[model samples]
Target: MTKFNKTLLAAAVALASTQTFAAGFQLNSQSATGLGRAMAGDAIIADNASVLARNPAAMALFDEKALSIGATYADVNVEVTDAQFLGQDLGSIDNAAEGKFIPNAYYINPVNEQFAFGFAAFSNFGTGADLTPLTEVEGTISPVDLLGNTEVATINLNASMSYRINDALSLGLGIDLIQGSGKLSRGSLVEVEADGWAVGGIVGLAYEINENHRLGLSYRISPEMQASGDIMYLGTEFEDINIPLADIAQLAGYHQLTEKFAIHYTAQWSQWSSFDSITLENPSSPEQILKDYHWKDSWFLSLGATYDINDRWTVRAGIASDKGVVDEQSSLSIPDSDRIWYSAGFSYNFSEKSSIDFGYTLVVGEKVHVEEKNAILLPIDAYTESGANYFSIQYNYTF
Candidate 1:
């Protein structure tokens, strides 16, 4: 590889470290029912075993053992327009990150009226994008460092226990065993891959004001994960680097106005401020900064309603505003911005013991502008338009 390419490659590697397109790389695809309602009142619904994934305290609302299995397909489209690299006009790259599938499962067992146990498995953060258009310089043979292809995936397993203290109050606790992995490749010259595990915990509380009103609160404490991986640059190896994940907290509520109508709301916060930078180091030297994230804390708010049409059919609708975490620092890897969500869904009860749910959501992001200079003296200026679509299906069985 050429010297100019090496410099550009370093910048690409740095930017790729923190470029997550989905609300700063945190996921809200835990349950299909939640997706139908734009994730409103996720912690208090307690309609199925999927509630174990959001708030274990909700398990106290169940009287029987139950299981839920679901999957979501996220189709994302990102476009870069009027891109200028070192003052050269380059048109655009469409569908930067196309389609990704996320799957989840949960189970709950109520041993008695006051005690319940449950478990859940799901994906918290994942992304994939291609930006090879920025790797080549216009009208020259020299290397220009733009973003390239990158992929990241994480899986979280949780086991929880809930105690019903009385008719109106419940408390829950759980532990998390998270596994994360990722890879970054820049023009075949620089490739780095790594995988590791991290431990975390969750605490939740739920209160029933009456038969028609309920409230819930939950907090997730996820510590930074230090991944031990090999970083290869131009055939040189740098082993033992660190990667970080953020923490989150949420408050949710559910209200039933009549026998056939109900509403839900949720307010969620993510601690993106904890993630300031990415560092990589070897056993022989001190740590080096890959990139500076400098992200700010963010919030998500949602409201939803459900209508019962008959004994077996129900419909749902909702809207939400999800804040972006980027703090004046946007890159070519993925343009991060605030998003608006519109969603709808339906459920059909096959019998008293089984049911099926389908949900869809549309996410539209505010236009974002980017202008940044890498160490190679190349400047990347571009405007990005981004959006996403989600389709999900879930099945619940009570025994």
Candidate 2:
């Protein structure tokens, strides 16, 4: 590999290792009905079997067997402007944040009046980024190797059971089978790929104040995910690197003010604090310290209202604000910032036992100024603009 490409690869790894995309590489497009309300009351809204993925305790609200299948498409746009490297102008470049389709499915069956069992297949986190635009700079001797792509994907399979204590309370427990994989490439100078599986668990509780009000709380624990794979860099191979995921906690409330109108809210916290740094080790050589992410915990809040327009149609609207995990450690690879969500949707009940839900969301992110310092090259100051539009549709059936 050319020396110029080598340096560029090093710089790319430094920026990409810690932050990939979607608010520190976490995905929020899990449910179509939930997205319609910006995920408001995600844990307490037991309108369908999708609740099994969000809060298993909500399964107590079901009296019959049900199934839910859905898909969400995210169209993301990101741009990096006014980038300077070693006092040289690199101009503006747009990142390839292509549209991604995320799919989900769930099944729930009631064993008795007070017991329910459920299974779900869903994706909780994912990201992909292409920086090929950075390779077209006019300079001949590129001091950095930022010409590569990175991608990460994960799927979660869960089995859960809920027990209704009485008319007003319920409890739930679940086990998660998480599958994950990742790939990073830097112009043939460095290529790394890995895949793994991990075990986690979820616990939840739900309380009903009356026919019109409900409250729910849930927590998810993520086990350490170790990816055993080979890495080829500079004509050398390294094996068995580890990657860790984070846990989450959620609280939600649902209130029906009248027969036709209802309101809901939620508060969610992600344990991003657990991700302090990115370290890659080699058995025969020194460790490669890519970055010190220094990310703090993150929070999300959402508020929504539902209006029953008619017997067969229901409309919903919502708003949400999500706090960024990286306060000062932002980079081009992630470029995550505080964001707001505006959403709207409608559900059509085709029959007593079947329904379809459609939702649309617009995500707007705050502009961020980044100043990344490099050991081999001068510091670069850049401005980033990021946003996304999401559309989703879900089908629900009850028997």
Candidate 3:
């Protein structure tokens, strides 16, 4: 491949991996109730049908049919500042991240004394950013390989079943149908588009120590996604690409301390170390390594509390720490960093069978210095800061 072609190909790889909204492009906006408490104890809360998104075993806690629908608006803010190449100012980009809305729905039904089933629709990962405007800097050479528009989205449709074994233990299994799509462009130098589907699953266990204490654990198995579309490299087109996704494991606990108060916590892990690289393949040539992430595993920890104000009102608050996944290898397209979450929300009981929930959270990311190589293998330096505000609402009903 020519030097110019190699440069643009590297740029495409960086764009393909860019995900700035959440750590490594993983999303946590499944439900408003979970968001309010930073997802603490979400796997075992069993307060509503939304629990199906986490642990299906929690369905055993309900004796009646339940439904929940909700949506979250993520207002993301990302700024790339003081970008330079060998002392030459390449300018900066303000608000490169885009805003989006995430939606979810869930339903649960108890079939008999020992069986329950549920369905859920939600997103586990997504990202969107536009840095194309930075390529228009005047009186200076633009870093064409480092600036572009990128958008990626994934949705998970789940069907789960739970079996109650005695009164203290429950086991659950779920099947996931994941849909993914992406688009990347760099001012005509390169444009890649793809869409595909994959299958995965999750298993969970719920243990009830007493009427006021419970614990839940779950592990999600992710698939290697294979997508086909227009993938151009050095004027040659490849028919397919394979992207590896990370698995997830989490443990959660809930303790009702008093008649009107409760405490909950969660420890979650993302197996990002398995997401080592991206590969491009075609019938005419051998598989080629498009990019190597060299990312590390990450953890997210959260603690929360709920308080009852009255028969019709309840309030909750939470805090969380999210560790970054980027390791020795970094990219300007991915400004990954450690983050903190502060959240609050409330539920209003309209009656015994219906209610509404509202939650808000502020995510703050640490500013970090990033170093990357340009087309000619020259070092480029930049500073990046990312943050977001999440507002969510949901309607829930029980029958």
- Which candidate model has the greater lDDT, 1 or 2? 1
Which residue pairs clash in candidate 1? Answer: none
**What lDDT tens digits, residue by residue, belong to model 2 across residues 1-399?**
101111122223344522333455667778889889998988998988888877999999999999999999988777777776666777776756677888999999999989999999998877666765655676633324444576666788999999999999999999988776667776666677666566789999999999999999999986544344646665667553434445889999999999999999999998878766555566787876555667788888999999998889999999999888776666555567888999999999999999999989898888888776554645566787777888999999999
Best by TM-score: 3
Clash counts per candidate, in order, are 0, 4, 0
Q: Candidate 3 lDDT, tens digit per residue, 224-267?
A: 65666777754668876676767899999999999999999999
- lDDT measured at residue 174 in model 3 versus the true structure, 0 to 100: 99
Error of 3 at 243 (Å): 1.5
Clashes of 3: 0
Off by over 4 Å in 3: 1-13, 16-19
lDDT preference between candidates 1 and 3, better one: 3
User: Which ten residues in a row are the worst by lDDT in model 3?
Assistant: 1-10
RMSD of each: 4.7, 4.7, 4.1
Return the candidate ranking by lDDT, descending: 3, 1, 2
lDDT of 1 at 308: 91
What TM-score, to 2 decimals, does candidate 2 have? 0.91
Q: Write the per-residue lDDT of candidate 1 for residues 1-399, one digit (tens) a residue.
A: 101111122233355522444577777888889899998998998888988877889999999999999999988877777777656666677667768889999999999999999999998777767776655545633233446677777678899999999999999999978766666777656676665666788999999999899999999986654555556765567664454556789999999999999999999999978777766667788888766767789999999999999989989989999998878777655467899999999999999999999989998988888777665757677888777889999999999
RMSD of 3: 4.1
For every model shown, what is its TM-score relative to the native structure? 0.92, 0.91, 0.95
